[model samples]
Target: MENKEIARVLWETADLMEIAGEDSFRIRSYRNSATSIEGYPERIIDILKDENRKVTEIPGIGKRLASVLQEIVDRGSCERRDELLKKFPPTALEFLKIQGLGPKGIALIFEHHQITTMDELEQLCKDEKLRLLPRMGAKLEEKVLRSIAQYKMRTGRFLLSFAHEAAEELKKYLAETGGVEEITAAGSLRRGKETVGDLDLLVTGPNATEVLERFVAYPRVHEILGRGANKASAKVGREGLQVDVRALPRESYGAAMQYFTGSKEHNVAVRTRAVKMGFKLSEYGLFRADNDTRVAGESEQEVYDALGLAWIPPELRENSGEIEAAGEGRLPELIELKHIRGDIHMHTTETDGRASLEEMAEAAKNLGYEYVAITDHSKAIAMANGLDETRAVAFARQVRELNRQDRGIRIFSGLECDILKDGALDLANDALAELDLVIGSVHSHMNLEPAEMTDRLLRALECPSLRVLGHPTGRLLMQREPFSFDFDRVVMEAVKRGVHFEINASPERLDLNGNLVRSAKQRGAKFTVSTDAHHPKHLHNMWYGVVTARRGWLGPADVLNTLPAERFRNAIRHN
Candidate 1:
């Protein structure tokens, strides 16, 4: 079993221990071990077995936690962790994942009515089981039900790219139909947050009044949630579509965009810096020494230059030392989407994707993209209907025919080959060599110890045919965490061996997160920011990867897809 899986089990054990009224320090140690195990640089087994090694060497772990880590890694389970969990009903820890319920509330529920599951809890809520208990009442019961429903109905936020596209569509429609001249998507979508909460568009046109009127009256506007003279809110299907239309002097457009696209913390940092310099900054523009007159600049860069600071990358504008970096003129040259010439990771009908070869080609053509790597899954991924050697070869032939037809898009027949349990490639080297690109990935063995998982990935990276590692960490948002692995070493080796890693744009799996991306970029390793889309609509998710790339402070030149098709193909073919 992997160290990460072991850690998760141990984490649950700790939570259960907490519910059972175990010693606070004891429960805290287990929880600490869980967090430490997540980002471990080496395998837990090696740490456990080594005489000189200490688990306290791992960050967030101390001496008490170290022994627990050793016991879990060496014996596949820890007796202390198990013993504590046995005291509490197993359901106690399970309820902790629910948002509103805390340890105390859970204890009350379990102690009173023996509620073990969500269903049982719901039944208790229906039967007024909590009302009879001391302190709990009818209103709290309703709130709990509401919280439970919310937990059940909760969906992850859309990727920034999806929000951008939606904004673009809305902007275009508003301008064409609503006659708005200045339409821009503001908020996190503009600032390039990795995920977006909602779509915010600011419009400024000759007919501001008419535009706002028409926007609120548009057919797609399901209900007028709110309407004021300067701004309005409406329901566009289920997602909250908040549209704000305000009348401002045209010169302030740039500042307005910057202000609205703020990480509030970042803006405060900038404002404080401005204050220190004896100047006042606002969304309207930079003011005079007295903080009253507006300066000239219709662009964000101009505004920053006026303040003697380099324009900060939107992704890094989260107040995390970016202001200091900007002041020092040491801002990172973020990666740009235009630098991506080709997409090295994608799917098609051969696996579990919506597009056909021709449709994908045409879409690439429309995007002015140079090339695409069609990496269908191999036979091992039965869930995705992966291809075998025979089918893979046939797919290559079809790609060759398409190339010959001069479709204006270079097609690289690639395989998203699975890394086997024993740290071997799913395809033979010869089979792998036939493809233009190879995106080796780990789908199983996710529960392996950090060392084993790292070894598995490293072995795959050592394969010459492996050009790109898709979603290197292999997380599924809140559902799962990356198993224990030596990511630092894995990235170092992948970079040294000329392997490309991906910032997968799948909403659920934005693996190779901004922090990791920054680390890899610093080492001169290349990356492919791909949508990893399963449907046509998903292709638009490229923006999510784009935003994530920006968050890593990546510029266009860092990504392989930003290259033109021929150059991209040559790079992959040779590397």
Candidate 2:
């Protein structure tokens, strides 16, 4: 098993243990081991198979955990997880996904009622029987109902990251099969949608029909849904993400790619344009309608040229003015990963971050960032050991000292200050003034009414130190909907106050989402694309933010940190 696969089992085991009322310390050990293995560079299986090496050498892996790891690598399962699964209904694990439901809540639901499925659970919530239970109340029932709706909406759909990883694996496998000449991701994966229902891969190769055999026998292939001469479909990964692979003839590769890599609306618009111009466009080729003679088929560029348009980028293939822009030669030069100059939103060991300030800076330097800001949490998040006024000021001094060193990267001291309930800053103005940048965020009271949330954000923007608003919508993808607020009003105030919106790069919380990002851009708001990194590995997630930026039609010029360190520093000051 891959390290990620092993870690997933360990995590599920921990969650199941929690539901089983296992000891707190033991459960924590499982969770910690999962985390350790997930980030460890080397393959745990390789280390385990080597007689001279011991997996226990890694932190957090004790003798018991080491044995558990061995069992997992050997048989892909452990005794404890099997035991837990046998005890709970099939939906026990599934119920944990509901927003307001916890393990204890699931355990209670199972004990009190013979609820077998989601429909029954929804019915239970509607019947108000859950409020009679311990800890859960009427509010929770309402929240669960909403969560179930959201969960239903997200069902069978995988996150873009999940599909991307799966695609990379398949692409690598197919490339290694020897005859594959080229592989291009099509569908929403190519377009970089935040969520995907399935993946479509278009391949051109000498062995057109033979690749399906190798794909069907892939180690991750859980089930072969179908097989054909030109295409093969399979359920891949533990998540059962559907993947379709097509082997294409090189002559029509571009046409197939353009037709298959479509948002249906975009495809319809382009096809209609072709029809009006007396051409028939299809996956086979673009041809003259009268003669049925091919006009263009070899390249996406040629296909677009045939349509009297410049080549449109894959990211802009959503019929949202991209077609018109392409015809007029006005499509944006969208932001790329190379255009990023810095990652300015990050945490350090001073608060919830796993890495020290020095370690994070070294990581950023290795990533070729011109500058990085150590934006640890402010006092509002006590659980994260967030900085108080004294600590915040001391941290600023420490960062200033670090800036004096020849570290090969510019370091900025900053805080992710909380926008508290009453619209006040978490730290005092004196403390905030000492920092280089402040990202005001809503960490609590997300349930506030729209007008109230707007007022709170508007007030937070009044702070001179607050250069950016962090994760403006407060949404956890597939987990929580964005908190309701008058986004237009808040963003207008932020723009007036010289504050930028943050496109937080964390996969789970890619807020502001692309829709909001585009909306804010229309209202004259600029953005800073940040990973909101809490660990060194998280720094690599900047590409995901770049994807969100490109999807929102952001050009490099629209992003503030694309500037060099000195210019960027001056721009965020709001002076």
Candidate 3:
């Protein structure tokens, strides 16, 4: 199992245990281990397979938990999860996906109503029945119904990172088999969509027949949905993501990639262009209208060249003006991962982060970054033991001391200060001024009116100490919808105030998504593509942020962190 899948197994078990009213310490162990495993840079399965390695060496992983991990890897489940599923309806886990309903809430509902499916839960809400439950109210019921609708819309979708892992694993498995010369990912995975519905792989080699056969027998293949000499389909991984693989002739490789890696609209546009040019375009090849002779099919560049356009990057293949931009030779040179010199929004152990300040700085330096910012939580987050004024100023001086030691990375002392509901900054002006930067964030009151939310952000921007607005939308991908707001107005104000926006790179919270990024960029707003990382391994997620920036048509010049150490320092709002 991949590290993420293993982490999910333990996390779900922990949640089930919590609902069962199990020991809090044991539950905390499971939760901590899950967090550790999820942020681990290497696959847990690989460590288990290595004779020299011990799974117990992983922090928080005791011998018992280690054995549980082994059992999970062996058959995709452990005894604990199996037992818990029997005690509670398995669908109770599904109920946890609702925004307003957590494990405790689910337990309350189950104890009172014994609801099994989403429909019953929705009915309970609609009937005004849940109001009688402890701590539940009419407002909670309304939120539950809305959350259920959102959950249903996102039921089959998996995060891009999850699907990417599955696709990469399949590629590696197939590469070992003969006749698999090249394996390339296509579809939404290639396009860097935040969520993927399914996976698509294109393969080419001398003997495709053997590859197709090997594909069906791969270890992760839970079920072979279909099979053919040149193509195959299967459900793979614990996520049961449907994967389709096509083995194509080398001559048609590029044509097939173009046809398969498409947004339906983009493909339609490309095909229409081909038709206008007196050529036929399909997965096979580009052919003359007057004859069946193949024209350009060897490479994507050739295909685009034949169509009298430049090759569009996969991230820009949403048919949202990329085709026109390509034809006009006006496509932006998108930002790349290598262009980033620093990651400015991250946490350390002093707040809610797992890693300490020195450790986070070391990880950043190892990644070849010249600078990093430790933007730990400010005083508003009581649960995180967030920093008050004295602690915040002390931490800034501590970072200053570390920088004096020339630890090889310039550590900027900062705080992710909350923006209070009444449009005020969480930390005092003098406290914020003691730091290099302050990233204003909203951690509560996400359901404010659109005008209120807009005004809230607009008010936050007036704080001169604020540099970057952290995860501006406050979205958690499929789990939560963005708070309603006038985005353009808020972004315009940020630009006006010389405060930049942040492209938060956490896979679960790639907030300020492509559309919003592009919208803000067009309004003359600058940005920082940060991981908002709480762990060292999470820093690697910068690539996902770069992909998001590319989708927004942002170039290196548009992102402040892409600047060099001193330049980036001087570029942001000076304290």
Candidate 4:
């Protein structure tokens, strides 16, 4: 099993144990171990192969957990997880996918109504029968209905991050199978869409038969749907995510890749242009219409060169005028991961983060960062153990002392302060004035009317200490929608106040999405791409944000954090 698969099973085990009323401490141990395993940079199997290694060296893995991991790796399954599966009805686990329903809720429905399937649950909601159960009132029943609808809408799609994880693992596995020359993931994944329906892989090599055989035999393959001489399809893991693989000869690799990695609109536009140019473009190769003379097909660049244009980036091939830009040579040089100099929005053990200040600093320094900001939660978010005014002051002092130590990376004391519903700052001006930076955000009252939300944001931006707005929309992809507000007005106000917008890099909340970023950029508003990381490993999420920014057509100059530390400080000060 892959690390992600093993971690998923362990997480499900924890959820099942919670419903079964197992010991709380034991359940926490399982949850912690799963988190650590999922975030681990290297494969657990690689670690196990080292003679001097011990699984216990991992943060949350103890002797018992290590034994379980070994069992999963060696036998392709864990006995404990199998035992847990036997305790529930065949369809009971499906309830976990329904929002507004926890394991306890599922257990209650099963005990009282014998509801074992999604169809039964939906029927019960339609009949208003759910309200008969404990804690299920009219409001709760309505919420359950909405949740069911939302869950159904998102059933077949997977988050970009999740699909990327699976694709990377599969790519590595196939590349290691001797005979494969080149491999790449295509389709929506190549376009960097926020969500994808399925993964499409293209491979070119001499050992097509060997690659096909190896793919079907993969441990994570749940079912083989079809197989052909050079093409294969399968549903993988418990999520039933479909994967399709196509093998091609080296000569046709580039044309086939461009053909497959397409937005339908973009493909139509390209085909029209090819027709106008007296050439036939296809997966086979670009050819002259009258003589069938092959022109270009070996590389993607060559294919575009034959079309009298520069190569358009995959992220910009959305039929959004990118073809015109490429033809006119007006495409922006999009920001890259290497262009990022620091991350300004992150947390520490000071407020709900897994890593400490020093550990986060070291990790940023390791990434060749010139600076990092410790922007923990304010008191409004009590669950994160947010800091009060006095605590904020002391934290600032501590950061100053750490800077004095010259740790190779500059540490800035910052606060992710709450913007209250009444348009008041959570911290006093005196406290805010002491910090190197301030990030104001909405933590509650997300249901305000459009005008009210706009007014609230306007007030927050008026604060002199406020530098950036974190996750302006407060959206959690696949779980919540952005609140209603006048986005244009908000962007205009941000520009007037000189408060930069944030492109939060967290995979779950890539807020100020591509569309919004582009809109803001047209208005001459600057942005900061922040990881919003709570764990050290999450710092790597910067790549996702950079891709999102590129999709929005943003250049390096449009992002504030790309500046050197000294220049960045000056810009923030003047703002």
Residue 417 in candidate 2 has what lDDT? 96
Q: What is the lDDT of residue 115 in candidate 1?
A: 56
- Writing each residue's lDDT as its tens digit, candidate 2 over 1-575 gives 89999999899998989998999999999999998899898999999999999999999998999999999999998999999988887578889999878888898888889887999999998999889988889999999999899889999998888888889988888887788788988999898888889999888989866788888999889999999999999999878999999989988899999998898889999999999999999998899999999999878888889999898877778899999999998888899999998998999888988889889999999999999988999888999999999998998898888888889999988899999998899999988988898999999999999889888888988887889999999988888889999999998998898899999988888888777888899999999999999889999999889999998999999998899999988887645
For each predicted model, how many residue pairs clash, with residues at least 3 apart or on different chains?
A: 23, 0, 0, 0
Ranking by lDDT: 3, 2, 4, 1
Q: After superposition, how far is residue 148 of candidate 3 from its true place, in Å?
A: 1.6
Candidate 4, 98: how far from true, in Å?
Answer: 3.2
TM-score for each model: 0.68, 0.97, 0.94, 0.93
lDDT of 2 at 242: 92
The Cα RMSD of model 2 versus the native structure comes to 1.4
lDDT of 3 by residue, 1-575 (tens): 67888899999999899888899999999999998898887889999999999989998999999999999999989999999988788788888878788878998998898778999999999999999999999999999999899888998899888888788888888888876677999998899999999999999989766788888988778999999888899998666899999999989999999989998889999999999999999999899999889998878888999999999999999999999999999999988999999999899889999899889989999999989999999888989999999999999888888888888889999999999997799889888988987899999999899999999999999998999899999998888788899998998888889988999989998888899999899999999999999988889999889889888999999999999988877876474
RMSD of each: 18.4, 1.4, 2.3, 2.5
Please estimate how well model 1 matches the true structure, expressed as its whole-model Cα lDDT: 0.75
lDDT against the true structure, each candidate:
0.75, 0.90, 0.90, 0.87
Poorly placed runs, candidate 3 (over 4 Å): 1-3, 40-59, 63-76, 112-115, 123-140, 573-575
Per-residue CA lDDT of candidate 1, range 1-575, in tens?
A: 45666678778777777676768987777776775575455788777778898767776687766766667766666787567556556767657766556777777776767556777887788888878877888987887777666545534455555566667766766777454568777777777765676666776666665666777877657878777776777766434555454544567777876787788898888778777777777888777767577763467787787777888877787887777788788987776656666666778887987668667767765776777778889989998899888888777777777788777777888889999987788888877888888888889879898888888888888788888898888986544566778988988998898898888988778887788888788888788888786655567667678878888878777887777666776788843
Can you rank all candidates by TM-score, best first?
2, 3, 4, 1
Please give the lDDT score for candidate 4. Answer: 0.87
lDDT of 2 at 343: 95
Top TM-score model: 2
Poorest stretch of ten by lDDT in candidate 2: 566-575
